[model samples]
Target: MTTNENKSENLIGFNRLNEHVVFDSKKEMNYAVADHLKSNAAFLRDNSKNILNYLAKIASHHNGACGVLYDTIAERLSITKRTVERCMSELKQNNIIEVVKQYSKRGGRMSSVIRILPFVTEKKAPVGEDVGYPVGNESGPEHPKKPSGSKSQSPSEKDTNLSNPLLSSYKQGTVVASLLYIFDDFRNKGLSRPKFEEIVKEAIPEAINLKAYVRSVCSNYVENKSKFTNRFKKHCV
Candidate 1:
């Protein structure tokens, strides 16, 4: 083959390889997000639709991002700039994504720095590694430790009312539905908040800390310390 022809063929081959790798990266990103939720079945249920949609969009657009602007996302999604900004804010608040200020050579406005998080799976103990202590032949790893104070409520108890209504304005039916779904997943895996929090950190790479959203149903419980404690006791066993 001619030298020029050989060079052309090599360039074509490199382009094909690059395309293949980029495609795999996108799939892996989406899968990582899904696996993060799977790891924390409880928190996943409570996530709003807006958050999920925003994530899905980011996954889809990661490949095309030389530098995308809010206007571009808003136009493509058929939503207003305010709505797009709101979703971005929520995603940032939740530690899902971070916005870095960047300038493009052809830019009018500054662009964001979009970084995808790494995938996190449970760490399995080595096949038969033994520590200084005896290894109990227990089935799986011991169940994850729960948070210190949160407990479950019985069926007959009534909910409390709150002085600060905003915090309590979380929708109960939605919260419960999300919680039930997540808790069932947690039960099957025998995991708890600390473990679940670790998984959430993996999903949201920029998130250094994790916090649950205040549920609307719990609004009444926020007024007085006594009322909050009583209501907390009533709902949770």
Candidate 2:
């Protein structure tokens, strides 16, 4: 073969080799993430594990970043929207995911863009071997330790009520009253007052009018009690 023919063959071979390397690297990265999750399962919340799994699936489909809808996730997972919100918060707190953008509208709400963070582990390379990546004792992002008596708020809760006076006006008691009135079936369902308050606190952030939002949620529950029970099994169970 001529010199030009040899050069052309070399270029084609390099391109094919580069493609294989890229594919293998991605496959290995995925395996590493799964291994890290499995190894650290005990330290993560139950809901957080579910959220991570869901995000992983989403990331696989969307090329590393995706928009996550709290309500849709709740509906699909048979959990309350509050649970989904809390799960996402936990993941962010632990440095497992980051919110790329916040969801908002003039009078409507939408999903937030989320990016999953890579899991790091303390695996030392053997002597005289090159691992290509740094291995350290620390894993993931280090968050400052919260002081005692400090309460952590989720991303959704940060500026929600501050911008909306109607949402801020409805206190815990008012919300509970609205829920009780609309959800008559829940009156004798053995649900505790504190749990009700917790749900109200979570739901208030997304409410344009707190009272109306609670009433609507309760009305929906009343209209489809069985579906509500199934959808909110995390709370009911």
Candidate 3:
């Protein structure tokens, strides 16, 4: 009773599909799927290692199996559709996967082509690492560890010796350590107080009117160490 039109429109005929069709026989598809999965293996491990094995199984089947679909991914991982959407967004934000949308011939349905890319390397610390105190006052202590072969100087003696400003805090942490880090960062660039303000503005764009804050902090820093500030004026330049 099947007509020519029906035969032509029969996209997937479950009755006619051979048992061998269950396993993918297409070599190129298999290799492409495997390579794509491998490229994003690091992301799988870092974000959700539990989904790695399931993702691999789904990716391995490639006999016209359009890459990785959202529903299939959700089912395989036992995750909700919303959860898959969230994970996909995170992966995209982190540059783990690239989704390409294209039109399919069958009923003009839109299909997504998944391309797994290498894991992104974040340069800055994730959040709450607390590089240093954004605001502070008062003179802090000198570093506990002394330079090799040199006798450790007293707090006042250390201040006098560090007239260059670059020789301030010898270790990390504390307000002094933060200041020393900032000083050394711009030493080669020949930064002044105004230039330092520009860099601070870059870190905090909303602080465009933070000039008053900068002036107050700098004034306090100078007032607390007037003697040292005078000695280190040239170094501050």
Candidate 4:
């Protein structure tokens, strides 16, 4: 082949490769968010997944962010606006998404800017691995060595998860729904959120896997509510 023809073919091949390749950060991150929620069956309930996926779909086209209107989301998802609000509350508490800004005009609320956060894990790095690089290491609930007391909020405050609420409930670095559910049960039972979360946190390290423990607690906590605490005390306390 002539040198000129060979050069043209090489350029064409490079161009063809470029046509199919994508390196957009927003697209990649939106995909990671979708995949994380999809694979982790126990990460969140289906309702949460629906709204998250919808937001993600919008965000993919809008540079990793999109405006949020609860009514619009409700209409599109075939759910009540209250349900959308409540699930968004849960997502906020779990650090799944963040609201960058809220808009208001004429003394009335308008649509808010929502930022989609990609799911992450808190796995311990291998020994001698570089720990200097920053990861999303949340200082989660600690062991219940000496429970520090805090002013308790009213029941409504606990339910609402207010930013300025009196009590500090738990938030996880990783999305573990059962842990949060058990904490919710404890909240209903009036067990102090911080203390109980810590107590449960300590026991987690000793378990081979949280699956059996979480399943037992979750099932017993529901099926045998009265005896749930005693069974849990035997294992976790």
CA shift at 35, candidate 1, in angstroms? 3.2
| Best of the two (3, 4) by TM-score | 4
Compared to the true structure, candidate 3 yields what TM-score?
0.29
Better of 2 and 3 by lDDT: 2
Scored by CA lDDT, what does every candidate get?
0.38, 0.50, 0.40, 0.50
Report the Cα lDDT for residue 11, model 4. 36
- Give me the runs in candidate 4 sitting further than 4 Å from their true place: 1-24, 38-40, 103-110, 123-135, 138-237
Tens-digit lDDT string for candidate 2 (111-228): 3355555555445646754332212222223345557664554433343223323324323333443344333345455444455566577775456566576656654544576667
131-193 per-residue lDDT for model 4 (tens digits): 221133333333344234533433332322323211122222222322443444445554454
Q: Against the hidden reference, what TM-scores do the models get?
A: 0.31, 0.37, 0.29, 0.40
Per candidate, the number of residue pairs that clash is 10, 0, 0, 0
Ranking by TM-score: 4, 2, 1, 3
Model 1 residue runs over 4 Å out of place are 1-24, 36-66, 104-109, 119-237
Instruction: Write one digit per residue (lDDT tens) for candidate 1, span 177-212.
Output: 223223333433344444443344332212222113
In angstroms, the error of model 2 at 129 is 32
In candidate 3, how many Å is residue 213 off? Answer: 50
Q: Worst 10-residue stretch by lDDT in candidate 1? A: 130-139
User: In model 4, what is the error at residue 11, expressed in angstroms?
Assistant: 45
The most accurate candidate by TM-score is 4
Cα error of candidate 3 at position 188, Å: 59
Looking at model 3, report the run of 10 residues with the lowest lDDT sum.
169-178
Q: Is candidate 2 or candidate 3 better by TM-score?
A: 2
